[model samples]
Target chain A: MATVASNQRGTGSRLKTWWTILKISLEERFVYRGDFALGTLMRFLPIITQVFLWYAIFAASGKEKIEAYTANGVVAYYMLTMISRAFSSMPGLCSGIALQVRDGEIKKYLIQPIDLLGFLLLTRIAHKLCYYVIALIPFTFVFFLCRGFFENGWPEASVLCAYFLSLIMGFLLGFFMEASLGLVSFWFLEVTSLAFVYNLLNFFLSGHMFPLDLLPDWAAQFINLLPFQYLAYYPAAIFQGTIEPNQVWQGMALEACWLMAFIMIARIMLNRGIHRYSGFGG
Target chain B: MTGYRPSYLNVFLTFARNSLVRDMSFRANFILQCISTISWTVMNIGFYLIVFQYTDSIGKETGWGRNEFFVFLATTWIINSLVQTFFMPNAQQFSELIRSGNLDFALLKPIDTQFVISFPRVDWAALSNLFVGFTLLCYSLYQLTTKAENPLIIDWRSILMYPFYIGCGTVIMYSVMITLAATSVWLGRNQTLYNFWFYITNFSRYPMEIYKVGWGMALWVFFTFIIPVLLVVNIPARIMARPLNTMNSQMWQLAGFAILATVACLMISRRIFVRALKSYRSASS
Candidate 1:
């Protein structure tokens, strides 16, 4: 029997692997610099229309408020949404693996004695983190433009620090959820369509384009019941200082529970997935 | 650019028919995709309308009403969709073909390779997106423009300019895509760049004026001369209505710009595509 490295799941080892994966992914992305930059530039288009619509809404309203939000608040909230996405966790990498495996390439991965999930999570997270780091330039530029319209909003250091921690936890939960979706590809060959539905559901629930608070009361409550809020709104609300600090622990507790649950699901899936593992060996 | 004589219309028919037949082979997938696209389009448009319904007018401009904005958004998007259907996919696929040493097979085929490669695939489902876009445009136009409501006839100039602008728009889009895909020759593959292109399809939905003056001018120049996205919808509509004096001159300059860009880029990209094909040393023995 081979040595299976029982203690390899320690945080330090995982961190080192994550760092290496990030470096490798960053190198891969560096080759497509122009495309990445252009994509960053292209992303501004929808926001442009959004800003225009807000300008119109302001014009139409004759200085009115919808619920608790003023026109400026709505714009700020959306801008915050964009910023949140730049930092939000990525979708699962299993979608790519699903395709890679179907093409019979996953066999190469099986020979490695190291933890596969660690490598998968590390590399995918690295690419997104780096992509967002590059993406931050534009996100900050827009935020600066947007900040001019808002009231004073640089939060206190302690609250801000708490928000930052919550943000990281939020990202981890979101990553775990999406990565689990990718892991599902071990069984399903065409997860693309499923991914579409998954992302669309997330787009609405995660409060990406609109604040969940803006949804009808019932809809808002329904979405809150799901885990998507921890993906975006929890962190965004903290940054906006709209959410209270006492609530932070509640949110974090929920995030921890879901993270634990999803990690178990992933472990189960990985184990079961190996039994039916064809490794493109059909 | 020497070539054996080939019937232009026949080439198109063959390509069109082949794509149609191939797509028909997976009839249910095509229908499902159509339904998916329709729902997706409605969701997007609904999101805009929700925002619009809550607002008085965009830009705080007196004349730029909500319906007009929707009309503007929808019309341009439809034309953009048509261009996407025609050009964007092929450009993306062509880049892939080059990367895989697959372009060599196309060059071997007894046809004008460009004609064959450009229209060899079809997604008729996108046609539903076009219909939705057109219907939304018409509905919004009726709400905004009194002339349309009164059944007053369109001026010859406006009618003529509509198709003319579409032609210019196609040329502009084709030029941008052709060049972007042409990067495949140097970059090994540009599928990542392809991701950038589709995401920007939302840009032309708003009038260029919403951007501050300097940026607006920059957009006019870039979209007009380079990407030529404006000719797809905005500038043409601007010409039709004589919305702004500056816009009228822009439409003409844009058309001329598109023609020049198309000829120049097509020559360069084709040569590069050919060169890349020659560069390929297959991994297989």
Candidate 2:
């Protein structure tokens, strides 16, 4: 390959490659069509189980409100949680990075022209964009099918729009954090322990199953310091109106702050990790 | 050198040993895995309790109170975890072995390639799910005995039938994994089946009865003919409840399903793999 001068074309050309990466990933996804159909349906089973649990809670309280959340509000909260979860890659991307490093495939990327971290992060974004579009179908059908399953008002829509952006921010925060942790593989052959601790931290802090409001104030404050809340809670809070729309922008701004800090941390980790790669891989 | 074939017994032992060694190498992985998986099960158990702490029952009709839900969930958890340990990993890797052109590596061995690939790795941590499920069963049983209008003790008849139920469940789960793994042949090079299967396996974690009867029947077919998971879950729960009659075909269905699933998985996989091998030019292309 001839040396090519880096110029304005570099940015344009890189963006073009990212789009091409998307096409390749989509084509790659087609091979698993069998899974796409049955797998998508199977994904909803957990929500069904969870909904029943929430239903039990509503029934037991003998009142529709639990800590100021109405029955429909609670249901809608989980439905959004489930939908956003379908878009999540925190645990998966973390584990994938570890596996790549364990198998020495990360070395392959060192020789490549494009940035490995950039390519990986973009690949997941593109893949999830496609996968979640498929998830949106059943999600919408379920949203409409259940009677009294309402999506609040214009305030709610605006909140949801903010929530959607926060969701992207959440994914980024998670991706960068995990990628940074995965960089630990440069020293350790397996990062499964670190990955496990991270995942447990994710479930408890992100509010994947239950919202942050459900936790005690101190519990809430502890997770608030971490980026995990920005991953699931901020988005979920906006969806449930738990934090109130009057203050929703604060959550959005917080999400922006977490994402920026995470990205910078990831770059530092990557630079230091690559220098220590050592090449004596599995 | 080219025409070697080992006995099926040898293949089984080799694959079993290989997976065991791989798992043992990461000694800490087993403990971490067990803790995480158990934590996940505990999370759901906590969720189950939280729900039952309220409304008392669903829709006021099914009226499945807490003990019943625990019993049902315990059964689901055990079957779900057992299947995860037994078949899911192998199936997930089967797709990978094909996609990465690693199938050739598996095939070149003296043993049957399918047998070698099928059980090449085991998740020792997933065994924690099995332990948690058993504990859940014991807890549920105590709850049932104390809370029941009539305290029902564990009966021998039910105990005997439970294993039968578990047997059927394993058969069905294994069959589902094998069929999807076989799809990698035609798929050429895609790990989508692996991810798709992992997502679906979470289905067994929930109470299967939540599905409407029509959809239940559809899932029954999907689980049996397609996914066939109830081969592990529904059967175990039914046997513990009592022997099946026409009222609940789960027990009878499992009996038949196990044999049918096992044979179907073996034969169909053999045919597809042989055919796939005939056509594949492999990585050299």
Candidate 3:
């Protein structure tokens, strides 16, 4: 019992250190308050353009439902997607990590007592916290504006819990996947094109452009088998209640599996990269 | 003044050649960039393929059927590729230039500051999109002519007008990009320029008819009159895709409007750029 208490105390202090880093990260984010707010709001402009396109599609088709989706349901899916994106999207994180690896800045983490992955994850958590804090008002404004478009008002508490869990996993999965991509910089002198290619695939495969459900049956099934769906589509589907209650647990398990797989990939890449790393200059 | 500033054409050619040499020096990176751009266009095509499987047309009232819509998509790629190749890299560097006080050096140059800043680098890899877009446009036109009930008439006149309208699109896109880039002077570090640019240009990719609904009218007027991007892709795509009977008067009107909008956008953006320059304090200041 005494040993267990000591172990608990050790874990507590470790978390406290990370929590302090998170606080500093959050404070650093506040330096660009106006940029944060304006950038978040402006990102919604594409969604508005998409909404117009969908409105036109439904109007022209004169169909209340398209592929098991009502217009309102579709709109609801997009709104939920914004929330999922808020959690999953890590702007410049990949390139930032890649630059650190390329420029030998990763040596600092090696020399320091801090763990790089732990530091990055905590910093990311802080970023998301501050992002949502700044973005909540705009999100509320847009949600209220889109209230009329939601056929089902609110999801069940159980569904919300699952959805929230999926979002957290999505965040982890996104981070690890990009971190794995960034670790490639240890081998390649330039990772810009690789980053671009990754973004192109991610933007399409993650269902940021449209709902994965809108894809053909085979395509949707195949995408579901991949990890990208958990990043955006699965969480939105859970919130939309498109996935049944029984399937929610299964989806969460898959998300967890993907998160684990990505974490492993990142670990392997980081190990190999650090082994291969050569300093540019003394 | 250095023999009439080396002639604008000579200056641009020199910059372009220098950029090409720099690009060729990194052969593997250049090839990868080409692959990346082509893959993005292909993925976009795959997306539209699934969307079109559900609906016959993008905007049914506007007659942007699969082939016609592809034409519009192709036109978008063409114009966007040109902008990305020639201007985007320069615009992105504008903030860094200001931060480093390199703009002062640019101002000291004998040639036009805008010209020097805008075309100092040409992204050769983005030209890959131009080839792909052109091929897609040709294929779509073939499908339209052979498959449509009323086949499109590709006259010599329309053929001549196509490049001119494409030039208009490029100018308008350039104006908007430079104007956004100039905001860095006042905003300290305009890191959000790329996102804002993407958001604004997203409208130009689709048929403008979609923006005719409820709140879209306001957007339509805003993008049409204020930003004038609605004319960018729409006029060129319409001229290429619409039937000859419908194209006669509407074609002239659209062509005229595109020219006027291009000039207006250029003038307004130039004024904004000049004003931003006046407001700019050096890094030391």
Q: Name the top TM-score candidate.
A: 3
DockQ per model, Cα: 0.38, 0.24, 0.62
Q: Each candidate: what lDDT?
A: 0.67, 0.68, 0.85
Pairs of residues at least 3 apart in sequence or in different chains that clash in candidate 2: A59-B55, A60-B54, A60-B55, B168-B231, B169-B231, B169-B232, B222-B227, B223-B228, B224-B228
Q: Give model 1's DockQ, 2 decimals.
A: 0.38
Tell me the deviation in Å of residue B243 in model 2: 11
For candidate 2, write residues A177-261 as lDDT tens digits: 8888887777787777778777776776677767666665686787777777776667767766778787778767776787788
C-alpha TM-scores of all predictions: 0.77, 0.72, 0.94
Tens-place lDDT digits, model 3, residues B147-218: 747887787776877888999999999999999999999988887789889988998888888998777899
How would you encode candidate 2's per-residue C-alpha lDDT over B1-285 as one tens digit per residue? 567555676666676677778888877776777888888888778765655544565434443456656767788778778778767787777767766777778777766666776676666668788888889888877876676476556678678767766766666556556767777777765566666565566556544454434345565467556655545565566455422332256546555666677567656757776676676556534
Q: Each model: TM-score of chain B?
A: 0.80, 0.79, 0.95
Share of reference contacts kept by candidate 2: 0.23
Categorize the docking of model 3: medium
* Model 1 misplaced stretches (Cα beyond 4 Å): A1-53, A64-79, A89-92, A100-119, A125-151, A246-253, A275-282, B1-4, B62-64, B100-114, B138-164, B186-188, B198-201, B212-227, B235-285
- lDDT for B240 in candidate 1 is 44
- Candidate 3 wrongly placed segments (more than 4 Å): A1-9, A272-282, B1-5, B248-252
**A162-276, model 3: which lDDT tens digit per residue?**
8888898889898998888877887886777778877787788887878888887887888888888877888998888788889889878887888888899888888887888
True contacts kept of 1: 0.50
- lDDT per residue for candidate 1 within B1-285, as digits (tens), equals 366777878877777688778778889777877777777777777666666655655555544456656666676667767776677668778877877777778787777676766776656667777888778867765655565443323467666766676666666566556656766767777767665565544556666655434445675566655565554666555554334333446456754665576566556656765565566554322
Question: What order do candidates take by DockQ, descending?
Answer: 3, 1, 2
